[model samples]
Target: MDWFTIKNIDAIDSPALVIYKDRVIENIQLLKGMVEGKVEQLRPHVKTNKIAEVCSMMLDGGITKFKCATIAEAEMLAMIKAPDVLLSYQPVGPKAKRLAALVEKYPATKFSTVIDNIHAAEYLSQVFSEKKLFINLFIDLNTGMNRTGIIPEHATQLFEAVQLLPSIKIIGLHAYDGQIRDTDLTLRKHNVDKAFSKVLILAATIEALSKEPLTIVAGGSPTFPVYADRKEVECSPGTFIFWDWGYKQTMPDEPFNYAALVITRVISIVDEHTITTDLGHKSVAAENPFPRVHFLNAPEATPISQSEEHLVAKVPDASLFKTGDVLYGVPVHICPTVALYERAIVIENNTAVQEWKVIARDRKITV
Candidate 1:
């Protein structure tokens, strides 16, 4: 009768992803509640759950806008007829053209992307202009993540230059404060406010020049609570859909349940203190060190090493386990772990009901 227990799990193959249908719905509700039922401000990123059916569930719950990292995720949202989709990544070269094609194909859905530099913006302008199309853009700000974004000090100049591009329109600012994930809520907010002060100044400067209010999209799961109270900003939290062990440990304040897991079985008995499972590097997110996956059934089984096909673990007593014994595990990182599987077995009321294809996991889906 446990929440993650599947009575008919024997039908599911080993090293497969499984989603609890009801828990996913609960997580969506929790996300909406954080914004006080303001679904308009909830532009969730679909990178965690790439399945079309999962996105539809968010749509059914009155979420219209979405954020994605790739063109395929955008197309998947469009396929579900999502009202608005933002490709958070800056597209250059062929990516810009493929995005333009997606826009033309899904006329009903409004698509936007982020730009950090004028070169990328002008290139996108050329690509969209050739197709006789216009695209909306958000100025990407680097809020200490040092990833792919322009610093706030020099962003005004870049924003002004991008304004001259005819094929692209400046919609707003996109600042991902992904680096502000302190466990203490007060300290986390202070850091977020400190970094976002520059963003606010940049927004004010741009708004004065454009003579229009600018939309601000910001934050991920760890910093979601900090940005949730800001009535004007759109919060993009992806992993809340399928809560993982990483965030669950790091962001203890956010009370999202673990809704997805990898079900694997013991393949061999290595020694009295060691055993191996089918959950390997190919089955889960192996970027982190040992304990990449925590076995829900056998919490003491510590992962010692992982290869492409198997994960060796140090258990208290291997005699307690046998071949074909199933072990439900929660991955430390679920986003990339999800991309490893093509489908997820949907569990409803402790029974495996159906399979939901991880369609958007592919790089190209008829873009």
Candidate 2:
């Protein structure tokens, strides 16, 4: 698989993001090794690459348990009726109400949702009860993200609320602790270890009082190395399959073969100091200082800035490329940038071989 490299994505089309399947599998296998086949569960996050083929590969690699960020992704997977699928995001308001309806239809499927607010918990309790659904309820503990989840201390209260509901069975605790850490290696390690330690305490507390043992779900793409070996529950980390520039540098040795590369054509060689390509922010997420450029015969170049349909990059020896030359860009944010395209043109050595559908991709989720 490593012998086959993506040929030339630019020759195929523009405004396209390409995925190399073999490399992706290599990436998954690399991460899988880090877990040492020791973790009780391994649920790969589907947000990074929503294509069923990629999910199938992860499933093949002893990751039957899968996590998704959207109700739509879960609903789509439920349509296929995939086993052990957990909606990792907090399901609040009417959306979960609509989503809860899905559970009754597929009782064989194991579906889980995260709860942080008692109101949301109470809402789910009623919704699941009304639907006659048996849901594996999880307490979303905010280890470090500070965006969602109840505090670690409040997890027990949320667990108690599930008991009150009766329909929602307390099953797990989830926290994606990677986002809070900075680029610093030691800081990332300390933050990830601290977050998981808190989750460990919550899990122990739940077990001490409740008859049912609680499963802990932690780790993200960046911090999986820290939490993967932990004795706690399972691991679900996205972006590891196709790591971005930010993550590639951070985890240099980790497997990142499955990453996507956007192939762009050099449209305007504005000057010696600046070169322009067909792709821009609309095609790739330019969150980093610049986009990483990977031309076939040349070294990597960085996009200085982007416009609606054009990318202005800083490149040396721009004389080789005319207006018709091609360039490939590795996006900064793998998750969000993957969302920018409708479908991924999967390639092997510059030839378009397969098409992967990006399922359940909704930008605006109305709560």
Candidate 3:
């Protein structure tokens, strides 16, 4: 099957996730400029773009700190040997324990993790021994969202437990705006203010007890700027790394930096308002109810209503496509969606270019 191979991408496999390297660097530059001399420096989450090429782009923008979700991701960065890396997601299972052991293999790497509960802390601390690995302790504050953090009031108890473990150090807090969830600009601002105020209080308490106070590492793309402007917290914005429908509400203008896109060929023409494409649940993440096309000028093209094998797009503009014509799919949830794919078919100007492996896609559970 022939796919549009713009420039050097005429030979890659089909149904691939392609990243415009040039565009990614541009977006990285823009994102960095937003935080220029603002915070301690950016530690962009690598979960957004797992490819080495994208990580290199972030390095080009004076960013050295990286936040990774999986052990595979941390290992990949260790393989790349980037100076600074943080495993953003906690390694909480047998797989995670194996990853923590890898830390001894690479002594020069700076690794940190988050923990709110004692079971998770004890599990990770036991693996990293002899004060050899000092894991950063983040009091995952549940301002409201109860996903994976201790209550703001109970952070000290968790910290004291990790402190006793001898293998860990309570470095800081890993709070984010997802716990707030209020959409009102004023109300959201208020929520962020109160939430962070609690974070600062918690951080200061940790600082009072220890020689090195905790580094408050917290952020979500939606309220990043609010959190970024603060002095105590280090901004870790991943959605801004590759803007998608899931990230559009956060960035009104230049939403999709043209970084990530899915290439799928039109498989059927069901009717006037409906067109079937090969992209489906496996290609896009099911987290967001609706997915939209960045270029279609309408959401119905892929409209978050998606099933497993087929995406029935309500396309009224029938003239723009044919049976074999191709278009890219822009996912609402870029992270899990990208994780679902095996590799990204890197392209430039609509051609199949290079194959970038999703090296850290499956490091789901880290003990």
In order, the Cα lDDT scores of the candidates are 0.94, 0.73, 0.68
Shift in Å, residue 195, candidate 2: 2.8
lDDT of 3 at 128: 70
lDDT of 3 at 274: 69
Question: Per-residue CA lDDT of candidate 1, range 105-189, in tens?
Answer: 9999999999999899999999999999999999999989999899999998998898788889988999998888899999999
Tens digit per residue, CA lDDT, model 3, 86-205: 776766766556666667766677877777788887877777764356565566676666676777878877777777886777767887667654555567678788777877777777
Tens digits of per-residue lDDT for model 2, 24-74: 878877877787865345777888886767777776676667788887677
The order of the candidates by lDDT, greatest first, is 1, 2, 3
The C-alpha RMSD of each candidate to the native structure, in angstroms, is 0.7, 2.9, 3.6
lDDT of predicted model 3:
0.68
Q: Could you tell me the lDDT of residue 26 within candidate 1?
A: 98
User: Model 2: which ten-residue window has the lowest total lDDT?
Assistant: 1-10
- Steric clash pairs (candidate 1): none
Q: Enumerate clash totals for all models, in the order shown.
A: 0, 10, 19
Structure candidate 2, residue pairs in collision: 5-349, 6-349, 6-350, 7-349, 7-350, 8-350, 23-257, 23-258, 24-258, 242-259
